[model samples]
Every structure is written in C-alpha cells, then in structure tokens.
Target: MTHPLTSLSGKKGLIVGIANRHSIAYGCARVLKAQGAELAVTYLNAKAEPFVRPLADELDASLVLPLDVEKPGELETVFDAIREQWGRLDFVVHSIAYCPLEDLHGRVVDCSLEGFQQAMRVSCYSLIEMARLAEPLMKDGGTLVAMSYYGAEKVVENYNIMGPVKAALESTVRYLAHELGSQGIRVHAVSPGPLKTRAASGIAHFDALIDAAIERAPQNRLVDIDEVGATCAFLVSDAARALTGDTLYVDAGFHIMG
Candidate 1:
C-alpha cells in the first residue's frame, strides 16, 4: 500500500527547464514519476529536444513539448496542450535560470541593463508567468516549486547578477503563495547546496563554490540531484500541503552556518 503523504499516484504534473539528464528538473521528474505521478516535460528547443526527449521517455512523460519561456507563444503552448490533454494540473516544477555570460562573470554593479533585464526575465519572471498559466489548470489546487540557491540569501563570489535575480525569485515565491493560498495552491523555493549542473557551469569559479560548500556544510558533502529531488518530491506531495512561501534548504545544514 502506498503512503498517502508520499504517493503521487493519479496526480498530473508539468516540469519545465529540463536541459539534460543532469538538470534539477530531470531529478524532480524522476522522483515524481517514481512516486506514480504522470508528468508532462519540456525541452528548451530543438537543440535541447534530443537530450531531454530520451529522459522524458524514460520517465514515460505523457507530454513532451518544447518550451522556450522567452519565446512569446511557447509557454502558452505547453499549458494549452496540458489543458487539452489532461484538463488539469497537480504541480509544476520550474528549474530554468540564465544570465548572459558577460554579466555573470562581472561584478553586479558592472552588469549591463540588458543583461540584468534578461536575467530577471528568464530566471525570475518566467516563474510568475508559469504560475499565471498554471493557476487555471490547478483546479483542485496544486503546488509550484522553483529551484533556488544559497547565494540568493547571501552573496557568493562569482554568483554576481544571479544573486539579486534569485533573491527576486525567492520573493516571488512568497508573494505567489500569499495570492494563491486562498485557492489551496502552495508555492515554495528549494535551495540546494552547490552541485555540478549545466546551469551552474555558467558561473565563473563555480568549483570554488562547490568546494566551500563541502568544507562548510554540516554534512561535509555536497547534495546530489537525487537528494534535491527527494526534498522536492515531499514539497509536491500532500504531506507538505500546509507549507508554503518558504525556502527549504537541502544543503546539509550549510545555510545555518555563521
């Protein structure tokens, strides 16, 4: 028998921002599917499709669509398909974030206006758009989970412009939770310890960040995608239904250090 708190059987979910097998989105998809939830996964574009499609297949995703959040119609298209195919949504895992290389490697003060705008749009605003599109589909009320990082709370070297952007993302989670709470919708940010991911690779000196995490974390180790996924799986389940608008760290106690 499945435990009601952990089992996701019969629930339908949409996962955005899967770039490859190593993506956090993929990890969440893996666990969610394992717990019996049906999923709809998206790739960024044709270039990403080849990599993401196979993983989606492995998860037995009911819908594998292209979703370039920056593209005008693409985001809407994915939700449209979900409504047409499943008529409702149970949860959404948003794991996409970006910043132009120039802005990312430079000091936050040196960040160009264009770069700042682009980072906010892709990394922060996209979640708001996803929540808007997801609201109607989450008829029975659902969850929205966004990936965040420890840098959002405290400055981390080389994290640069993304730090402020993620701070905004965290704030968005709180506001969304408040606005959507009355309808039974829950929102959360999952901040994981440093790990080698395609997105993290864009940060300059990312290795230093990983090393620092391992040295300072209470567990004295970095958390893997699977560990992050387990935390997200709980947030997406009914066991965490009462929790919302909070940042849950899966960083092995690293966030608690002075």
Candidate 2:
C-alpha cells in the first residue's frame, strides 16, 4: 500500500518560478507530480511560456498561467484561476529570486537602493504575498515552501546582495509559520547547497562555489535538483505536518562546516 504520509493523492499545488528544465521550481514540480499531486504551474511571461509550456504538459498540470510577481494583478490572477478550477489549494512552492547583474556581482555594501529593494521584494516579500493568498484557499491547512540558500546565513565570497535578501526570506518563513499555525497552515524555507540552475548562473564564481561545496560537504558530493525536489516533496506531505517555522537543509551537510 502507498504510505499515507508519502502519497499526495487528491492534493492540489501551485508552483511559481520555473524558468527552464534546470529550475528549482521545476524540480519541485516534478516530484510533487510524481507523488500524485495535481499542480498549477506558472511561467514568468510570454518570453518564458514556450520554455515552461512543455514541462507543464509533461507534468499534466491542470492550470498553466503567467505569474510575474512584480506585475500588478498577475499574482492575484493565478490565485483566482486556482479558486475557479480547484476551489482549494494544498501547497505552494515559491522559487523566485532576482537581483540585477550590477548589484549581484558587486559587494552588498555597493548595491544600489533600487537593486536592494527589488531583490527583497521579489525574493522575500513575494512569499508573504503568496502566503496571504494561499491561506484562504488552504482551508484544511497547507504548506508553503520557499527556496533559500546557505549564503542567507553566512557571507559567501560571491553571493553579494542576495544574501541579505534571502536572510529576510528565512525570517519571513518563521513569522508566517507562527502567524498561520492557528489556521493549520505551515511555512518553511528549504535551503539547498550550491546548485547549477540558471538562477545560480547569475552569481559570480558560482562554479567555484559548487566545487567547494562538493569538497567540503560531509557527504563529499553535491546535491542534485531531484534530491532537492524529494526534500520538498516530503515537506509538503502529510508526513511533515509536525514541521514548520524551520529552514530545512538539503545541502549534503555543507551548512555544518566552519
């Protein structure tokens, strides 16, 4: 028999921020679908729809829509579609983050005000917005998982402005979990070790970071997208009902090093 905790049958979820096959959001979507969860997947814009559409079809997503958090009404439009089609939601995977090249490649101290604000809005505040919109739909309770990184806690050599942005995201997860627990809603941040996703490509010296993680991590290897997906699959499953307000690490034990 399929374990009740691992099976996501009848559950409905929304995944935001799939830029390509290598995206963290795509990884999460793949596992969730494999676990039998119905999904609603979003693409960033017209430019991204072509790339994401094929993946959505492969997942058999019930709803495929555009969701650019910065664009007015786009977020609400997605939630509205979910409400109309499914009437409820069980989980949401938020895997979006952005910082302009100039800001991301430079020192945090040199980041422009606009760049800092934009990064925080996209990477951190968007989670808050998602939680708010998802709350009403998760009537029986649900889980909210956001992608985070080890750099959110420690200063990595080339992780620059996104470090503080993700720090804020982790804090948001804790606060949201506390506030929503009464409603049976849980929130968490999944921090994966260095990945080779398109988003990670934006970071300067990311290849070096990945190599260092493989060498220093206790597991003596790097975690892959599917591994991260499996961790997220667990997070959004009934087996993880007791876990919330925490940052779960899927980083091959790299976060423990000095």
Candidate 3:
C-alpha cells in the first residue's frame, strides 16, 4: 500500500469541538495529526475536559484550552494561546453546532425568536468569528473548514430549524472564501452524511435518518468518522489549495439522489 501523508507535515492547526473520541472533530484531528500536522484542541468545559483531554494528549496536542464559543472571551483566549504558542497557524477546523432542544425538535416555522437567534449565533456566526481571528495569524496563507450537512441544501425530516441554520453556515463559507481568497486563505464547508455523533443525537428520529441515508445513498452504506476526517485533512492540505467557496460532500453519494 502506498503511504499518502498528503504533505501536511509540520503544519500547525487548531481544532474546535472535540467532545470525545467519537466526535467528527476528533476524527479529523486524528488524521490530520497522522499526516504530521501539529494540533491544538479544545474542550467545551470542565465536564467535557475529562472526555476530551485524553484524546488531546493522545494526539500530542501542543495546546489544549477551554472553548465555549458562547462564553464571552473564551474563543479569544484559545486564539491567544495559539498565537503565544505557535506564533502562526496553517489551518483551523470548526465542527461545532447547537440549538435548544425545544427549537431543534419543533417545526422551523414554530421556532422561537430567541432559539433561532441562538442557533444562528452558535452554528453560523461562530465560523465568521473564528475566521476573523485566524485571518491575521494565517500569515503564510491557510485553509479554514467547518462542519456542514445535506440538511443545509434540502429538507431532511426531523432536522427542523437546523436546516436553515446550516443553510446560513454554508453561505458564510462562500462569503468568507471570497473575502479571504486574495490573501491565500481558503474557506470551505465539509458536509458529511448522517452519523451517530453526539450532536446528531439531538435530532429527533435521527436513527431513521441514518437508516434512510444508508438505504438511499449510492454506496448503500454509512460514512464513518475517519472518512470525514480524511476529507477534512484533504481540504486543508496543499492538495485542495485551489478549492474554496464550496461545500464538499463526503456522503458516499447520498446528496446526488434527486
């Protein structure tokens, strides 16, 4: 077998949203670290730190910080630590999204004003926030990638208000790519098919969504976290330098179905 390092060795990156070993962020971090990219990871809080800290250690992360995006100044603290430690960053992976249970399980039309706003702030605006901080630090040019989903394009049953939230996130990806392209910064959204992630567990009837994806996708199988990770590594690697302002699907052909 050919050893494909994807040429990311020595690249430094910050990964947000790693909850546990099963997180998509963890998967991406795993492959990126394997490709010899140095990593910095985050935990949402003290409780989550217990679950995420060991994985950060296993990945040999140079910096591990608390990062609750909604918490005032916490995001800045993480970036500050990155700046103090690495001086410059080559890439960043943003894989966080959230909505209140009441809003997530309800119809989009019925979603509360506060709930919708909160979801947009967390799931959509946070990318813009991160991109702003990363722009200057990406001095040598870099890539920024975020987690998105098929629900952003088409209505998936039980996805509820997140459909619109993801739609906004995808749009932000394009706008950020345009703004940052001249600086040699690439921005993209990686949309993977349904998986039993901690985030996905919040969706109502998520198991059925996964089953339908497996049955209807061209490959007739579900995508694993490692696959998602490898795709993320590709987007940030030199291999994908020319690629930006687009949503890359790693869904085993599920999105192509009419």
What are the TM-scores, per candidate, against the unseen true structure?
0.99, 0.99, 0.98
Where is model 2 more than 4 Å wrong at Cα? none
TM-score, prediction 3: 0.98
Model 1 / residue 50 / CA error / Å: 0.7
> Per-residue lDDT for 1-258 in model 2, tens only?
668988999999999989999998999999999999999999999999999999999999999999999999999999999999999999999999999999999988899999999999899999999999999999999999999999899999999999899999999999999999999999999999988999999988888998999999999998888998999999999999999999999999999999
**What would the per-residue lDDT of candidate 3 be over residues 95-157, giving only the tens digit for each residue?**
999999999999988999999999999899999999999999999899999999999999999
Over 1-258, each residue of candidate 1 has an lDDT whose tens digit, in order, gives 669998999999999888888888888889898898999999988998999999999999999999888899999999999999999999999999999999999999899999999999999999999999999988899999999998999988989889999999999999999999998999999999887889999988888888999999999998888888889889989999899999999999999999
Best of the candidates, lDDT: 2
Candidate 3 backbone collisions, by pair: none
Higher-lDDT candidate among 2 and 3?
A: 2
* Model 3 worst lDDT run, 10 consecutive residues: 1-10
